[model samples]
Target: MVIVKDERMSRKRTYLMCPPERFTVAYAINPWMDTSAPVDVELALKQWQLLRETLARLGHTVHVLPAQDGLPDMVYAANGAFTVDGTAFGARFRYPQRTAEAAAHRAFYEEQGTWAYVEPTEINEGEGDFAYLPDAYGGMILAGYGFRTEAVAHSHAQEALGRPAISLQLVDPRFYHLDVALAALDDGNIAYYPGAFSAGSQRILAQLFPDALLADEADALAFGLNLVSDGRNVVLNAEATGLAAKLTAAGYTPVLVELSELKKGGGSVKCCVAELRP
Candidate 1:
């Protein structure tokens, strides 16, 4: 049974995105990546542009982070940092290939001159593992570990962002990051696939968000939970029909966008966009 909530209010958001000019699958990190598979560079760029334009058309501000050469996965700006209330908690990627993207993220925030950027010591994948709920929920952060991020860094994030972070352990290799299996639908709600997490972590999620939407395995595999919500309008992968219907039932306007090309590198709508809560 799909859980439906009522009257979700909409809010405008600021997002960060990058062009997929340098995007390609040269190495395999996640299960989705295969060096043997072919990528259509033009298609990837087209999809990224549509995502950016759609967000802007929805009355949200979109910031472009220039794509650097040799960093194909740099288009996944959500992995760069977790920003809230003008403080940017920078990321330190686990793989050697993604490590340099961290410095570029830090530099972007530094150049902005308004944000207080924290230089990371722990190997955390920014918003990829850290999902922030605003101060309305006492500024709670749902942090995922056991894959891209470490449990110790939860404290580091808590200390740095001054927010309470609940640690969720990911067990499924495909849903390696919290964002892939769980989404912060709004400040007070979320949608997730239970199988992506450990048994204990599933219990934690249940206790915290009893009314949270649960995605079926099929939709979850479509990267449905890897979505960005501005409380009312949800931008997600086009193939996530089940999740999209559930969102509609719960009063959300699901704006479908195709990112199959980007998915070649293991990302979709949310992967290409980073939410900045001011």
Candidate 2:
């Protein structure tokens, strides 16, 4: 059943205790898999399984969905599910290649009967490019409109979620998703690679979060800012030294993990796992 909780009363925090009933994932089969990239299907399978076990170990219920053909590189499922107000809205994608992806994921969410789908003429890809930050002053959502998402999409999402979301346009092509350059820490802190964000957007972020830690290019490329929060804690890529130090200084322990292989697919912690916290 779907529950609509007031964002104001939820006191939503970055860190979360893993929810037991929600631990499954869906990944796209890498169509670019070739000898050069050497898409080891076995390795990919193993990685997905390991990720499932990791989340399971942390007290989550896990499920894994197979990647469909023709939608290679469609492994980013978080973009398909927009969770807010206890209702998950499956989104329609802007890219034609992702149309099937959005449809399939939307069907799945509807099957659960706990989510509502937001259908829009403009492309509205999900969380890969957007993040919902629930803080004390109310839930502030930061949206990144880059290569994968557009401003129109963000507006549609805001209307569907019934919440205010700050729209940030990402000008850089390399950093196609906001998660690629920024992360929300459990300690009410933000870790970001400023270069990936536009100067104006960076300034706004600074104003909103004056104590945010700046991550460098090396770390940014290494998925340094793509972190995962377990309600009260976070796990970051091991290479984010500066970020780790800052997070530790802020009174939250950082769990470091080696995700070098996933880096090949242009994803890190955030991309590897999707957290289901209420």
Candidate 3:
């Protein structure tokens, strides 16, 4: 049976994002990124503008972070912080390449004055490895580890958010971040790639969401699972045809946006977005 919960419809949502001003494939961080691959800076900017316009058109508030000169990966703002109920749990990056972003993100939150920042003790990549489910699941945090985020950070997130955090370990390099492997839909359903997870993690997901929609390798590789959802409307990569069809069949409005230029840096729609809780 489809897990249906009391739909709490909120028309307005605040999203934190950073523009691709300094975006470039300067180094290889993930499997998808290649330093040799050329990135179209102008095209990436246009695509990002379109994404922000799309979100604004959907009746949501978009808060932008000024892209710093040295932090190219800051464009993928979802890695910044995990915000829940006006509290922001800061990120402690695993790689030195991204170490500069932690301070920038914290400063943005501090300047916004919307969320109370909680400094994280362990290495965590923020919302890239963290997701919040619908109220049916008690708005619990689905935390991923074994890549950018350490398992110990789950407790830090749980304590900061005052919500139960379920840990899931990622096994595949391609889906190193939870945002790329799994998406918690607004209607209490989950869309995920089973192969991206460890055997034990897959079992935990199955137990928690029996009727979750599964994505094939093709869809997953297309960054289909990396999407932003407002419970009813889903914004995702335009190339994710199979996943888009599945979302439509499941009664969601799939708004497609092309981010091929940004994908060279191993990011797409959801990667550029950080949901804000007030």
Model 3 agreement with the true structure over 25-48: per-residue lDDT tens digits? 888879999998888999999999
For candidate 1, lDDT tens digit of each residue in 183-256?
98988889999999999999999998998899989988999999999998999999999999999988898999
Worst lDDT run of 10 residues, candidate 3, spans 1-10
* TM-score leader: 1
Q: What TM-score, to 2 decimals, does candidate 3 have?
A: 0.95
- Give per-model TM-scores: 0.97, 0.79, 0.95
Rank order (by TM-score, best first): 1, 3, 2
- How far is 53's C-alpha from truth in model 2 (Å)? 2.1
> For each predicted model, how many residue pairs clash, with residues at least 3 apart or on different chains?
0, 13, 0
Q: Tens-digit lDDT track for model 2 on 153-270?
A: 7777777777778888777666777887777764345678888878889888889888676778877766678877654356677777777776666555676776555555566677
RMSD of each: 1.8, 7.4, 2.1
Worst 10 residues of 1 by lDDT: 1-10
Q: In candidate 2, residue 176 scores what lDDT?
A: 75
Q: Which stretches of candidate 2 lie over 4 Å from their true place?
A: 1-35, 238-242, 276-278
CA lDDT of every candidate: 0.91, 0.61, 0.89
